[model samples]
Target: MRMCDRAGCDQPGNCPAPKSPNSPERWYFCERHAAEYNSNWNYFEGLDKEEASAREQAERAEGASYRQSSWNAWAGPGDGSRSRDELRALEVLELDPDADFDAVRKAWRSKAKLVHPDVRPGDEAAAKEFQKLQVAYEVLRAAEERRTWKGPEGTF
Candidate 1:
């Protein structure tokens, strides 16, 4: 086990403290020393108001992505599916990302008909494919709604 770097201390150094701002070197310290070091830490000491605010906002946005997701799975910024549901949805409908809603609907209808349970009765694979199409349509529809939704003041 590593010993604390604090002078005259013999405790196990379980916590790591950075030696300097943005430096790779680290100082291992015991819990008490670590707390003492952190108490004097100033993350925005050298930044101006605007710079500090921008950095703080960026950090919050990055960390909040985890909390914003419906589940604790790793999903992209929008449409909280663990997988890349948006791209997968587009692929399912055989449409490109730039395709409009009309194109999405058209493609979905065309492909869906081929796998639809009613058209391919008793075919388990086709039934599964139809389900995929339905899910893809739902994902795209929700995304479109989010893009167009205006809040209480009619502003995004």
Candidate 2:
């Protein structure tokens, strides 16, 4: 087990935290240390309130692509098991909440063909729509793969 990176702490480090803003390096911390670190963490500690707000707004807009899909309209009642983002993917594909893999595949194929960049070259809207569709398909496909995956020979 990895030891917590905090000075003088001796515990299994299960939580990985970034060492600095946007840095690739990470520091591992035990649960207690991780909580302590997060309690004092700030995303815009150095920026003024206006700058921080602007930066936050920009980041939200930049990350809004997947969130803009149809799934936002049909987010399931909060049970905390399924994320809003995952439900958004289902909305993008126009599938029922409990749709099977086959249904997901069919919806993806039909939707993707309409907004393919090649089919609408120079159309920015089409390109963006295609990107959203692609993201949605990938999310659902990955979930399906995880559900159907089998570990080596009866071990799972």
Candidate 3:
């Protein structure tokens, strides 16, 4: 037999668990009291709207930082100063402007892998290189499509 912990309740039964977040180990309340306690409980009761908003923003920023950290961790390292445009231009030249779709795609994939930011996390150079690769791939792909659509000797 146990006593209900709520004040003014003398009924003998199992003591209800405490609903207070502050003293979980020491406090206990009967069913009705616990319900009341829970209804009034507020984790952010004292915070003003601005304060709450600021806290939320801070939390969001922290989350972004953590995500960046994780991304960097996975990416390993960053290239020093290579630019994406330069990489793309080099790739375009290497693949040959006249290369077919398969060749172009293969070249783009190889270049992308070599310069992807994730592959070189902290490297500004890698980021630049990767951008170049993307630009080159896009330009080449568009040109190839246009050439195909034009057909042999401008025929429909």
CA lDDT, every model vs. true structure:
0.81, 0.78, 0.60
Residue by residue across 89-112, what tens digits does model 1's lDDT show?
Answer: 988887765666788899899988
The Cα RMSD in angstroms, rounded to one decimal, for candidate 3 relative to the true structure is 21.8
Report how far residue 29 has shifted in candidate 3, in Å. 99
Regions more than 4 Å wrong, model 3 = 1-93, 150-156
By lDDT, the best candidate is 1
Which digits, one per residue and each the tens of the lDDT, describe model 3 over residues 70-131? 32333221232223443455455485423456766887798788878888899998898777
Score every model by TM-score: 0.50, 0.47, 0.36
Span of 10 residues, lowest total lDDT, candidate 2: 70-79
For candidate 2, what is the total of clashing residue pairs?
0
Against the hidden true structure, what lDDT does model 3 obtain? 0.60
Task: State the lDDT at 61 in candidate 1.
Answer: 88
Alpha carbon lDDT of residue 7, candidate 2? 94
Please identify which of the two predictions, 1 or 3, would achieve the higher lDDT against the true structure.
1
